[model samples]
Target: MTESKKARSPRKILIFVVAMLLLSGSLRLGSVGIAIASSPEDTEPSTEDGATLECVTDAETQELMALLRERSDRVAEVEATQAQRQKDLVQAEAELLENLNKLEDAETRLAATIQRVDGASSDDVSRLTSVYESMKPKDAALLFEQMNPEFAAGFLAEMSPSAAAGILSGLTAEKAYAISVVLAGRNANAPKI
Candidate 1:
């Protein structure tokens, strides 16, 4: 029993010494790693004296520089694209406003042209009505018979009621009925407004 105790004591002492050495080594490594991780400025490689070669060959340092450069390039590219999009939006807004102004001008001109045509058409109808009123019913009836039913109806409608009645009385019953139908239906589809 005494021999076994002596033997176990030496083994325990050797294990304790080895464990202390390993703990010191691990603590040193941990402090070094912490210093390197804090910031690049803390241990940046420099050769201001031109003779000393700092640890610039470290892969982690090179990878950090590459990542910073890539990020800077991406930011610049995004800013340029944003600027181009703003310019395009401004140009499109200007073009759309110009088109809207041109459309308004065209609409005004069209309205004027329509008013002129309507005035001319009314003047022509007034003149024809006057001519028919001067003629005898029998003569107007002969002329109306040769005219399209729609055309005869339009002329009669433009005249005074008495004159239009005289002209209608002159027409053949079938001709008068057809013209009356056209006149009656002419405004059927007209908008109330």
Candidate 2:
């Protein structure tokens, strides 16, 4: 080969080597890029004036990059978990609120049922009292004798004074006394205030 061809061949080889190194990612070019396959001594950064600067080796940079990637992935995973937890909590809260509303509705319905039952019971008792008041005193006294003293006293207390007195007069002394005692003691333990 001629001298010019020999020289050009070396330049071409150098260019090919640089291109290969760049493609392989072993060599990097930037404002302050480094050769990953270079010696440790060559890893130090320098300026145009040859002033050395602190720098890490390619292996250390790669390790630090790996660690950074790992930390970033962990952070992303944590964020995803937190988001899922938040979503679950919101759903749980909504369910709890719905349950509370259902409970309130049940309570309202229960209150209405109880009030209706109480009103029906009161009406029944009032009608029974009226019927007893219209009966003959001796007839009412006979029925009262077979009733519990407290039960008899409840009916007697609801009657007019004249009707109650007439019924009492017709009852046996023992039954009358027992019913009277129950009526008298009904509010004995009640608060006066």
Candidate 3:
């Protein structure tokens, strides 16, 4: 109504409008904060829209991975040891086979030598005697002792009886007696010349 009252009235209305705006702004801010607090935190990005998400730390996962790595290393070490042992076994088997071959070869040679030596003829005996005559009487006696009794007796029959007697005389009494005994037996255990 009055000029001063009109001016004061306009000021009060402005104050009221400002208060209402501030209250509305505060309510909007409060609602936004409550919505943010109530919402769930983002886990891992979803592979499917409805998929449940779980989270784990890097160090804990890495420790489990390290444990798996250690187990793999142990398995590798055991495999290596087994492989080495298998290789050693193969080597040992090869060595055994090689030794067996060498032994078989040696036995073959020995059998051949024995066959040649034991299967001598009368002419062979004469040649052997001639060779023996050049040797020491003791050595000759040893050869005669080792000879088959029948062959030695036949060879003795072929020799000059005097030479044969001399060689017999030269032998030790024990050997001479053994020869006489063998000669006397009709079933003497000796091979034919």
TM-score of each: 0.64, 0.67, 0.37
Give candidate 1 misplaced runs (Cα > 4 Å).
1-58, 187-193
lDDT of 2: 0.91
State the lDDT of candidate 1 residue by residue for 1-193, as single tens digits: 6999999999999999999999999999999999778757655464877564556567978898999999999999999999999999999999999999999999999999999999998898899889998999889999998999999989988888898888889989999999999999999999998
- Can you write out model 2's per-residue Cα lDDT over 79-120, one digit (the tens) per residue? 999999999999999999999999999999999999999999
lDDT of 3 by residue, 110-166 (tens): 998888777765458778767766666666667677776666666555566566776
Prediction-by-prediction clash tally: 0, 0, 0
Clashing pairs in 3: none
lDDT to native, each model: 0.91, 0.91, 0.78
Model 2: number of backbone collisions: 0
TM-score, prediction 3: 0.37
Which ten contiguous residues of candidate 3 have the minimum total lDDT? 153-162
Q: After superposition on all CA atoms, how large is the RMSD of candidate 2?
A: 13.8
